[model samples]
Target: MTASASESGNTVAAVDLGSNSFHMVVARLQGGELRVVDRIKTMVRLGEGVDARGRLDPAVRERALEALDRFGQRLRGLPRGSVRVVGTNTLRVMRDAQGFQAAAESALGHGVEVVSGVEEARLIYLGVAHSLGDDGQRRLVVDIGGGSTELIVGEGVMPLHMDSLEMGCVRLARQCFPKGRYTPRALDRAALRVAQELEPVARRYHNAHWAQAVGASGTVRAVQAVLKGLDLSPDAITLDGLLRLRECLTRAGRESSLDLPGLDADRRPVFAGGVMVLLGVFQGLGIQRMVASDGALREGVLHDLLGRMASRDVRDQAITAMMARYHVDAEQANRVSGTARHLFGQVRRAWGLDDEAEAWLRWAAETHEIGLDIAHGSYHRHGEYLARHSDLSGFSSQDQAVLAALIRCHRRKISRKALDAVPDNRRLRVERLIPLLRLATVLHRSRLDDALPAVALRRRDDRLDLRFPAGWLEAHPLTRADLAEESTALKRLGLALRVR
Candidate 1:
């Protein structure tokens, strides 16, 4: 679910369950500016031992749960809509994320959103752009995490291109130097390997492409500290600084004996791996100087939540754009949205539906016919695909999945199997919303410029009765026919629809 906007926007929080660390920032909104009130972070290294088969190790899971429990305690008494939680690359790779996400969300006060790689890059760019001055330079922002690397090219508040690659400090450390030993040959091999991985990404990020390069995340901060210690450059990382740092570190040959100033002990094991990744980035992209950006994905999530609280909801705009692109009739969509919301209000409590579930149904109703431009047949399927894959700006990946499923089930034989395939928590929600969508479609089948009759809802053991005004259904023959057809549609879901 996106988020319920609070009319009196007071406070907002964002929790980033990152691969290398977990962070929570709570802030108060005053005079349209965010004032930081509280901040917390822990070096969980959550991506530490996720294997090729997408299983999180037992130790890693325990660490993540303990950290989330602590965060949960801190989030006590916060309003429901005030906090937004997001999971980064590690959650993206976890095959069984339900157990962990459920536990985490229980500790926190809201559901956890595991976004796509591109979405992560987009948020990182947003945080960077908001933090920095309006220098008007097209910047290349890099965030190397525990399991993924995000590269974004943008200027001002907009991003032109964004990509997330499978390269990071924790993953690299495990693959290259599992014993925490620093050797010239080992470092050389790691850097070359990272460079090789970048071969596909380097061509697109050539020097001519972006004016300035900015680094984000802990890996970059450690590199900056090592460079500042060497008296090389306090503001930006240079190629010479990297080469010199590698030489000095190689002399020590082990993490324990490294004599670099400002190197935190917690960062020791992954420091060598981070440096090698940086060296590869410099060599592959010809980057001479790179500065660190304090802002990252977590802050961007907060800003996005704030936008929703205001009236400028991006999901609404995205729906309008999708309808326009697919040539869905605006009048019909409005009609459906009206009926869907009316029906939702009628049975929300009976069906165990919440505000978030209601909002999703409304969104689906407004854009269900979005694939008619492709072809009328299987348009629902096409629309589902578009909703699933499109770069929907305001929606998290989970939001997209729910919206797409609602659309897919709107006209088809009620796909109980498909509903089962979704996350368990959402299966019942989809089941409940599909009936509302189907009924709304039936009410608006005439597609006429006329208002629908006031309807009431009543629930039986396993069936629903959609009662229209006493004589309204009898007077409208076409609506009667539509209801008859709807009966067949509802029957497929083991549900019976009665028209009164």
Candidate 2:
């Protein structure tokens, strides 16, 4: 979709392929202000079909495809870079998302990015922050979607802490009330499950308390609507309203027979389950009131895109943070990052790489030696663990996974089993970059004051040739030993690494 530079000139669209609902926002920018021209939402509940093995069922795919077709038609006139499409929790779970993403991109006439959960939380907070009119006070924002729940607290436009939990409306509904019956026992179980999931974050969230509570996404909207419909309050949801909603649901029992004017028909099926989870949230955290906001992931995406266009990419910050946290030698990191980037630039086009890969290489170089903190014995594994589990503030879940995998495989055996950890869609790209990282890491092993010898990179099928100055390896025996070991590892991955 083409985003017009002018409100009358052209339009930019943001499509949120959420687990519970697929949402699209068509808007035009006028004097740096966004005037929303069109908004579309359809409850697709993509999470409903995700099984234990993390596969998206055929039925869910069909529904999502059909919905995207409609959204695509609406986006036909938007400019190429004007439209941003993102998939949330369910998309993250899909092991075979390549096919789904390709089809969705074709239907929408735009690229679809399946972002990580932390990224999802970040966007949710941005949307909430913007919708709240730049409130200076730090506030907690909660977004409970069909497949995941995002909690974020931030002051102004920046989120200080963000977390995306696995619990969500659709997943909870399927797990707790598969028959679509809202029995008291079922409701209680669902609420308890949510409570259990929140336990990890509850104390910290409560202690790092916000002055106000802001809710986002369909569940929050539904709760606010029901409260208003009952003439309780239009401003925020109350404990009494929650209790009333739960009682009403328990009385109704069957989803089909339930009648609630405030709830939409598409939302009705999972409404009771979502309410149970929210009610648990209220009780678990001693929350008395919360104001729902219309802004969410989509708004966050637009704001982030703007930030990127303005050259303030958060991923850059993330790289810096990782380097500092891992206590990396700044000068050496810069040297490696520079060299890796140089090699990446030379081969990116030939290898079908892009900016994202470039960023990945930079980040991997920054933290490649993090394992040195632990015993240097297999520091690569230590680095991998740190990258994988560290509360990397700015990175999405997918980004972390990729970075961690690169760190893990940067050294050692380069086994096919190591690459198996990452998703199949990303495996090939990681494999292509691993040899370059290894070669760069080996060249920088000395970390000396003298200028390094010039190096050239050549690729032949799966093999790579690193031709250094004549006799450079002979002059540096330690470098020679490292290269000798690295060559053995590369050989296992069906690639030959030669050093001159």
Candidate 3:
């Protein structure tokens, strides 16, 4: 749901559940700009908790819950939609992520969404781009996180190219320097590993020829600080300065004994790993110098939240793009969407649905036929597959799952198994929306400009009563026959559909 100005209270918050740290930023909207109000961060090191089985360790879960409890105190009493919480790489890989997400939500008192790597790169770019003053020249942004690194090239606020590599400070540190002993051999091997990961996209990023390079993330920030403290660069990170720092780090021998100026105690353990990753990036991408940005993923999420509250949501754009790409029949989509929205207005209160549900319904109605481009046979299944697995920006994993379920259930028999695939907490909500979408699609099956009759709908428990203008059904025999079949299909799912 998009929050309006009044509902937003001119206050907003964003939480980033990163692999190594959990960060929360609270900002106030004033004069059409976000002003930082408060910030909190914790070194959760969530990536360390995942075992070979992909299960989050119980101790690690407790630590995360405890940290969230602290963050929850500051977030208390904020209206829903005023705050957005997102999880990054670790949560994306966990096998039992659903159970962990539920517990985390309970502790934080807000919904948690897991985003794709590409989406993560986009948000990071947005945050970094917004932090710097506008410059017409193209810029390259790099973010080295605990479990992944994102590289984005863009001009101004719009990102043109984004790629995420699966190498990070935490993962690399654990793999090469597990005991905090950073031997030259281990550092060389780590750098070599990162180079291999970047091989596929190195040429493209180098060829983009961005006028300037910017870095965003704790790793990059620390690197800039160390260089400045040592009077190496005095400003930004240069290739020469990084080479000097790398020499110092390798000679320090162990993370515990390293006494580098401007290095934070919390950052020391991961310093070598982060430095090696940056070294690899600079070497592979042919970057000469890079400056650090004050913003990161949490800041990007806040800006995105502001956009949604102001009704300029990117999700709407993503849906429109998908529709155009699939060659959806706009007229038919509009007909179905209009009918679905009209029906939704009548029964939303009874079904306990809000604007968010309405948004999903409208998107589902518009893109329901996306799979027809592939083949007309079982197009619903094809649409479901695309929606579920595609790297759709501005949408969380949960949002995609719900969308896939709605499209899957739009035609043919509404399978119990299909509904069960939706998140447990959201199953009932999708169940309620399925019938409305089905009825709307059936009403517009002829794909003509024919106007639909005024229809009234009511809900009581699991039963639905649909009332059309008198004699309207008799005038539309095909629609009447479709409704008869729909009624029987709904009955199998224990929903009584009574039409008059």
Off by over 4 Å in 2: 1-13, 27-30, 33-37, 51-56, 72-84, 92-116, 348-353, 421-429, 458-465, 469-474, 484-500
Tens-place lDDT per residue, model 1, 369-474, is: 8888788999888888888888776777777888888888998576665565566667778888898998888778778878666788877867998787888877
Question: Per-residue alpha-carbon lDDT of model 2 for 326-410, expressed as tens digits?
Answer: 7888888777777888778767877898887787888898888888878689988888888877766446555577888889988
**Which scores greater on TM-score, model 1 or model 3?**
3
lDDT of 3: 0.89
Each model's lDDT: 0.83, 0.81, 0.89
Q: Pick the candidate with the highest TM-score.
A: 3
TM-score for each of the candidates: 0.90, 0.86, 0.96
* Window of ten residues with lowest summed lDDT in model 3: 1-10
lDDT of 2 at 340: 83
What lDDT would candidate 1 get against the real structure?
A: 0.83
Sort the candidates on lDDT, descending order.
3, 1, 2
